[model samples]
Target: MDDRKKNKEAEKVTITPSDESTSEKGHLFGLDETIESIKDAISDFESGKILNIAIIAPSYAGKSVLVDEIVNIYSHEVTKVSFSSIITDKEEIPLSEDQSKIMIFDNCHYLYMRKIGGFEVLHAFLNMVLEQDARLCISTWNIHSWNYLGRVLDIRKYFPVQIKIPPLNSSQMKEFLLSEYEDGEILFVNDVEAEDKQIFHVVKKPLAEKATHGRIKLYTLKVNYVALRSLLMNKGTPDETAESIIIKEITRISRGNPGVAKKLWKKWLEYPIIKTSNIDKFSPSINIDVDSRFILYLILSMGYIKKCELNNIMNWKCSVDDIRINMILFELLNQELIQINDEYYSIRADKLHLVTKYLEDCRLVW
Candidate 1:
């Protein structure tokens, strides 16, 4: 056999689908409210009022789509400039524009770092926009990063009209599923179990007896890219690969952050498949070497069964090591995906709901 085929066969992993229906894009039922909000922002700016608006929230909070919708719908007047994973060169920012122009810069956080050496140029660009009565929309993961932009770019004068895009609620999730996945599956109304402590549900829904810090986390952009790419890679033909199914399922586990979802999906894809039912089966067990993106996912699953501690999980059939646990937990805590309480940590309730139905669709959880 060819080495490549041997390698793939050696790494063969098993995944379960929640259901036949899940979406792979758009505003399922309608993001009219969100779309209108963007249009309103544009209207306010086009009326000779120079505006600096900041779209802030956890990752997967739909900041890019919100602005993208505006740009897509009003392409004549809106100019889209993306700054993701690229060095920000201030000179490259479009500065010469009339009042009718609406400039959208996605991922502004990468630009304000002192290391980039482009903050001053960005400041100059913003100034030019204000002077020309043009509107500028900046997208970022959170408002905290804006402090860097403020310090370097002198945006305090603008104070940036902040618009918070909250994660999708249950109704919105249904719309998302309809738009992204196929139709005919039900959205989650309650959490369900797969087996033992392997809980499955949407990322934004409440799990059975889950502790809450009253918050939700979206995946980081890097994590999202990883997950989406992994899904595409595994499925091979874009046919009925488990990647899309994993996407919906992990969405319940990872919420909407493409990064976290990607990691978990990859891990799930990489998990060892020990035959259980002759039809090919593998029981979900904690294992080391899971990508850091699934830290919150493991933490969230703890609630499905009591007495499953962090240390014990490392020893499960999944073969998770202590070092991996420390690393994953540390990353989750740093990202605010999971908050530490007095002794235990819990997944953000909002995120749990987001991917709940996805899990159900994959049949990963009950």
Candidate 2:
């Protein structure tokens, strides 16, 4: 393999659940209440009441990490089966004749597709869950897919206990990111000057109507509303440290999603030190046709998918061939909206929210 392909493989290995131990996976930063709820549901299941759980969260928001933590808690009894691609048939599911009473299915959103006749496998799986009175099923789903399925199939009824992962606050984010490091091991540098860090800036834009044949420039003052709000909220706190500021900015940019925050942390960190100016502030604007939008939605829904899997989904849903799918993937990769690692494509971590918002605006995703 080429160097780029090797790097992609390495990244895939790093993020793979099997490659990391329970402690190395992720800290349950803001999920204490969620964990407690799942534990209660498990207890009820053990007591003859099969209270199945559906853990819902957006992609890269630590759905798998949460599932891993749950499995660790019930290591002796829980059996976890994580899906990395769509399951076109019910038989593809790995629910074996195991003695374990608790079954954890991660990425349960893969059970169905958005196309016609797509719910057959999911219906079958649900039926199986209903028939298996002795087994308790705990499934996880992409929030968008769960919403769509809820509207269409009323899937929420199948899972009695629904747990939505909550976003972490600034302090929680700091603790989660710093959990892997020793105290004072990592440095937070505020390299930008105070004046440079102002919440408002002047920008030049092209005039809507030019006075002459030549182009005209218009100067306007633009305010960073998010930064302004942060400043206003922290106005009374003058003793805040650079670490606090960096974590706050990270929490703001990542929208408190732990996976995104972790990726941002990796991007900004330069060994033991990270600077405020290194934080990513650039947002990619997505403007694509309906077909591309649907493809993007598929990637977001599945989390990580191979090109062949995309081809299969497109063939079933839209009758689009591999070449056209490749073109669309190329366009998305060029736009930095999606990335490929070891032939598996997923929404770029930094662009996850941006792509989801765009899809929502287009009504492609709920």
Clashes within 3 Å, all models in order: 52, 0
lDDT values for all models:
0.44, 0.79
Error of 1 at 62 (Å): 2.6
What lDDT would candidate 2 get against the real structure?
0.79
248, model 2: CA deviation in Å?
A: 0.7
lDDT per residue as tens, model 1, 91-134: 65545543335566655544443333435655665566466543
Off by over 4 Å in 2: 1-26, 207-215, 316-320
Candidate 2: give its CA RMSD in angstroms. Answer: 4.9
lDDT of 2 by residue, 322-346 (tens): 5688789999999989999877898
Highest-scoring model, lDDT: 2
TM-score, cand. 1: 0.44
